[model samples]
Target: MAERQDLTCDVAVIGAGTAGISAERAARKAGARTLLIDPWFRGTLCANTGCMPSKLLIAAAHAAHAVRHAPVFGVNPGSLAIDGQAVMARVREERDRFVAFTKETFDDLPEGTAVTGRARFEGPGQLVLEDGRRIASRAIVIATGSEAMIPPPFRDLGPRVLTTETLFEIPDLPERLAVIGGGPIGLEMAQAMGRLGVRVTLFDNSTTLAKARCAAVHDALKEAVSRDLTLRLGCETSAEAVDGGIRIDWTGDDPGRAVFSHVLVATGRPPNLKGLDLDRSGLALDDHGTPVFDRQTMQCGDSAVFIAGDADADVPLLHEASTEGAIAGRNAAAFPDVAPSERNTAFTLTFTDPPVASVGASPEDGTICGRSDYGNQGRARTEARAEGVMSVYADADGRLTGADLCCPGAEHLSHLLAWAIESGATAPQILSMPFYHPTLEEGMKAALREICGKTSQPVPESRDFGNLPGG
Candidate 1:
């Protein structure tokens, strides 16, 4: 028996996470009859669990590290202690306040709109909820984001074997921890926990952190790792439960095992595409179970049906996901004959200590033209904040391709690089500008000097400035 209920809307958005919410709001503001759906009554990960909470904890860890190291600068601080529980409590409270504010924005949608439930496609223009209700729309968007992937051996993520999803729930600080995977999540958590007095062992199948980043980033991050972390690179793990904690078993030349108080699997994430009954709508899923969609416009199968966020098969981040969702929302309601805006301009920041942030091509994808140090070596030494590297990539003709940073002012530096990459700022364009001396951004100038074939005046190596030397 074909059960059918009539529903209609100008736009239907699924998964009200960052991307979904942005798209929903934009669609509604454009005078479209919009309906948005999500399972989290309180809200999605960015609202409750992902970016917001994780960054708060990372920031707290940074503060704790700075205070503990104050004595080295002749500022003696007696008895520095990290109350992990208190810090986590503050994170939760802040998260609650943010979620409440988000709810207000979502709740104020104009009347004659709104639906809250698990929405799945029933047909080309129809959706069925778990509660047996149905709605039809001119367009449907699947913005459902991603979920953490746990391989079979790690299925039992008990207290000690944790994923990012459960990492923040620990009641006490771990004495020693092993973080598996060296991507953004792993590197960020490894650096954060290591700063908070946890002996962090970072295990990665690959030798480099964020292989997508430029090669120079590995050398810069290796310097930071030299300070607070144990880098167990180029090792694949065979995990097993043990007495005090779990032991990560691995084999390479000089193979060994290490036991830690806890193990965090920051491996990677997969699309949360299950249970949507995608086949019910005659939609095809790729082998990995992500929705197949037009990469440029994010439109899946029929032009009227679209998907965004982690489920879109390429590019996943709270920042990217939301932007993609907004585009999908606009494109879904757009006339089929009209072209969408140029495919999304995106940015990503890895919130590690002396955080590594980048935009555009991975080092492997482009040519590295210039490099400079922020903290220990060059101008940053004079500025008393030597902490990171600024490296840029360009095409053979000197057009901007990508850039990476690991330093004190990386957040601000990333903003400028983002603009450069997005605005098609040629290498010469950036090189032409004279930066203020003794500032962190001088690293950018040094890098530009290298690209422009100008010899960089080397800063003396004798001056430590307390910033560690290169890897």
Candidate 2:
């Protein structure tokens, strides 16, 4: 029998997904000899099946939808025939290109810096490969990412059921799709499929869509999406196999029995920590079986091991994952010495027709600084998308703190609010900024001005401020 080989590195990063890649790069840049290990080279779930592919599908769907509605703009386009197969093919092709790009980036790393194998922890600061090779490292980073959580009841459905992990690989779009969650992924796919001419029914046990913290935003989203698909919210549901497809029975405000060619489960995603043998590493797990680690440093239980990205099970967005990965990598490379870093203010977005976005803290009973109902906004009326709301929250002192937007340009608006809140910009300060006429941003300006009027603080006079030559 062949003897087991041994390797050594200053830092070992498990999983080559987005977080893993960021961690590895950070470690190497911090002067640590880094080794990255993964079972495949297709990059993270986002590249393979999640963000990229879904966006491609959504873009195509949006194109079809636009052409169908172009008559409103006095530009009458001819008949639109959506070739589902062609759309799927384009999505797959673009998805492969992204995957190849990520793989190439990994391949260009210093030779011998990466290994392709399944790795598991043998003990503290030690890893065992499938081929009997052992690796020793001063510190380790776990960025294994996550997978679609298939509930126990749906395990036996075979190919008839789909999740984000496997949804993009299908050859053709199902004629009837039953989306089993109302979260970001579920809503995105449900609306996209419906736009592409698929019969879609969306089910959610929760009473609200996207779990919007604001009641107005929730109502606007539910009303807007109902125009596309049959939304069954606040439902108790069960499923069973039928000859041609699966039958779903539900009890809700607008529920009944129906059959779908395919069922998509987008309930949630848990950490992917199946075989890493974390118990041997001296790290503790929470009641939910997720590793307990310091959110700021990504360090776990005074050990050299750190956790980040989807494995952390706190923030799952791509941007948050990359940020967490950098923190984990830098701290792991520095070991006994920790680097001081503060997480960015909270920001998240969901891409629907009228996108949903939240920034900084959730709006509570704080003073309402600004508000805009898109239904009356001129820009929205021009774009024929005038059907949502924008709200800004501030403390009693009139400093911007948070916002919730369900409007035509919520994505961009959210970023603006997040930056203002992070920088301690006051309501009057935001209102003092220039807002061009006949634009969607005018709505934001209106909201800001409203809040400024309500604030007890005196508004700064524009004439007293320095004026540029253009002004």
Best by lDDT: 2
The per-candidate count of clashes, in order, stands at 5, 1
TM-score attained by model 2: 0.95
Worst 10 residues of 1 by lDDT: 462-471
Superposed model 2: Cα runs more than 4 Å off: 1-4, 365-369, 459-471
lDDT on C-alpha atoms for all candidate structures: 0.73, 0.86
Residue-by-residue lDDT tens digits, candidate 2, 106-200: 86889998889989989877899989899989999999999889786567887989998888878888999999999999999999999999999
Which lDDT tens digits does candidate 1 get at residues 286-405? Answer: 887666787667777665788788777587777777677777877777736324556534567877766778777767774756777665655455434576677787776666777877
Q: What's the CA error at residue 335 for candidate 1, in Å? A: 4.7
Best by TM-score: 2
- Residue 402 accuracy (lDDT) in model 2: 84
